[model samples]
Every structure is written in C-alpha cells, then in structure tokens.
Target: MKKHEGLNCDDCVEHLYTYLDGELTGETESDVRVHIEGCGDCFGHFEFERTFLRFLEARAKAQCAPEPLRRRIFKEVLLDNGSEAE
Candidate 1:
C-alpha cells in the first residue's frame, strides 16, 4: 500500500482496532478513515477484522457455559469474597 500524506498502511493497521472501537480522536480518526478509503489492502484488512468480530459476538451470544462450569465460577467468586458456598 502506498503511503498517504498523513498515514501509511502500517500506521493505519496499527490504529485499526482503536479506530474500529471509536477510541481515536477526531483528527486521528479522520486520518485513518482517509487512508482506508484510498488503500485497498488496508480497507480489506479492516473489513475482515470487523466481520470476524461480529462473527465472534454472534457465536458468544449463542453459547452458554455448562452448569458445572457456572457453579465452579460461582464458587470461585464466593471463595474470593471470603464467603462459604451455601
């Protein structure tokens, strides 16, 4: 990917996650947005990570911990709090 005026593909990739998470300031975010719009390779990488995060979110929502695992977590929390399991 060619280097843009404000950011290159490497800089864009470095800040990709922060950009996706809306953690960047206005100017920095704009720089990343402009770079991705002009750079096909960086844009592809951004899209792939976005899609992968969505897939993981969906999978997490569809699954649940087993009863034994849940109980074990509860017990651990109680122990950490210095409380006996009832």
Candidate 2:
C-alpha cells in the first residue's frame, strides 16, 4: 500500500495516546493507522511514549515507594493543602 506524506497536527496529537493504547475505534483508529504509516515525527513520538510506559512499569516493580513515604506525602501535601474532608 502507498504511504501518507504527513498528518494534521490535531490528528497526530489527539489520537496519539488512544491509538497507542488500542482505545481508538472506527474511523479515528483508521486515521491514526494511516498517519503512523508515513509520518516519521509522529511515529517517533508514539515509540517514545511506549518506551516510557515500559520504563515506568519496570521501575515501579523494581523500586516501589515505601508505605511510610506514601503516608508522609499524604500528610504533608494532601492534608497540608486542606484537601481533607470535614
């Protein structure tokens, strides 16, 4: 099949995450597929996001935050910010 030359910025940015997550449907999904087939810039962005998510997952598994740290953050930030319920 022939490749597209470029995609409109809106289509590139808007559908990017959805397309990556396989959340797009119908015409929108088709549009993203067509765009990625040819647009190097957008494809690069898609690849980067995928790689980043993989890194985040691996890091979360390798070095999880301690429960005390979570509680401290909640008390210092959330409670300090007055987000507590009455």
Candidate 3:
C-alpha cells in the first residue's frame, strides 16, 4: 500500500460522493478506507462529510410533508407554471 501522504483533503472531498454511494470499486475503496483510518486530518474531513450527508438526508425527510400538503403544494405551485399546459 502507498504511504497515504500523496492523497489529501481535496482528493477525499472529491471522492466522498462516490464513497457514500458505494460507487468505488476494489483497490480505490481500499486505499480510501486505509487513508481515512490512518490519517486523522483526512478522517476528520470524512467524518464531517458523512455527517453533512446525514443532515441533508434528515432535512429532506423532514421537508417531505404529508400527502395532502404535498398535493396542495404541487397543485398550487407547480400547476401554476403554464409551460406544461400545452
């Protein structure tokens, strides 16, 4: 395995979406996991990113209103846009 110095926070941030979505394949995922485990700075960055993603997920869930409210908003908001009327 490489010494992990060559990779930095930028690299970690860039790959974070892929890592969370499980898009990384064999060796790349292994390398990222190793770097996160060994490097405190990179690990902190990863933790922050992970927590941010979780917060976004929670916010999205919270923003999802009840079905009647969703329907009312959709009809009042989206249906007001006349572009799709044709």
Candidate 4:
C-alpha cells in the first residue's frame, strides 16, 4: 500500500477503534486493514489497542453472569409484588 494513495497513519488512527470494534464496513475497513498490515507503527498501535481490548473483555466476563442473576431477582420481586396487588 502506498502512503500517498492508501490510508496514512494519521487517517488510519481515526478508524482504528471502529475497526477493532468491528464497526467499520467494506472499503473503509479494508483500507485500514491494509494500512495496519503494512505500517509497523500503525501495527504497533493496533496491537496495543487490541491487547487492551482483550484485557477489558476479560475483566467484563467476570461480571457477565451476575447481571442475569440480578435481572432475574428483580423480575421475581416484581412478580411477587404483582401477585400481592391481585
């Protein structure tokens, strides 16, 4: 990818987060991918961001099941209150 024609690092940085989140589509996504693969600096930034995202995801997993349990408890409380209102 040519620096003059393809996305330069400055342009690619704007899309990096969106790219990591799988929010970018089609040509824009393709352009970022190509630029990251070819540019070491951009690739480094991508790696750091990707690793940080993985860390966040790992931390979030611990709380994932608790949200469902909390929701179920709240629903049950609501149902009990509804029965009392009958």
Runs off by more than 4 Å, candidate 2: 1-7, 63-86
User: Over the stretch 1-86, how does candidate 1's per-residue lDDT look in tens digits?
Assistant: 53446898898899989998889997789899989999999999999999998898898898788999888877787565575534
- TM-score rank order: 4, 1, 3, 2
Q: Between prediction 2 and prediction 4, which has the larger lDDT?
A: 4
Candidate 4 ranges beyond 4 A from true positions? 1-4, 64-86
Q: Candidate 4 local accuracy as lDDT?
A: 0.89
- Winner by TM-score between candidate 3 and candidate 2: 3
Error of 4 at 57 (Å): 1.9
**What's every prediction's RMSD, in angstroms?**
6.1, 8.1, 6.2, 4.0
Error of 1 at 30 (Å): 0.2
Top candidate on TM-score is: 4
* Candidate 3: segments with Cα more than 4 A from true spot: 1-10, 63-86
Instruction: Report the lDDT tens digits of candidate 3 across residue range 1-86.
Output: 55444456677667877887789987678767877788898788778888998998898887656899889878877886655675
Instruction: Give the lDDT of residue 85 in candidate 1.
Output: 34
* Candidate 1, position 3, lDDT: 47
Give lDDT tens digits, candidate 4, residues 12-70: 99998999999999888889999999999999999999999999989988755687788
In candidate 1, the residue pairs with backbone N, CA or C atoms under 3 Å apart (3 or more residues apart, or in different chains) clash, namely: none
Backbone collision count in every prediction? 0, 0, 0, 0
Model 4: pairs clashing at backbone N, Cα or C within 3 Å = none
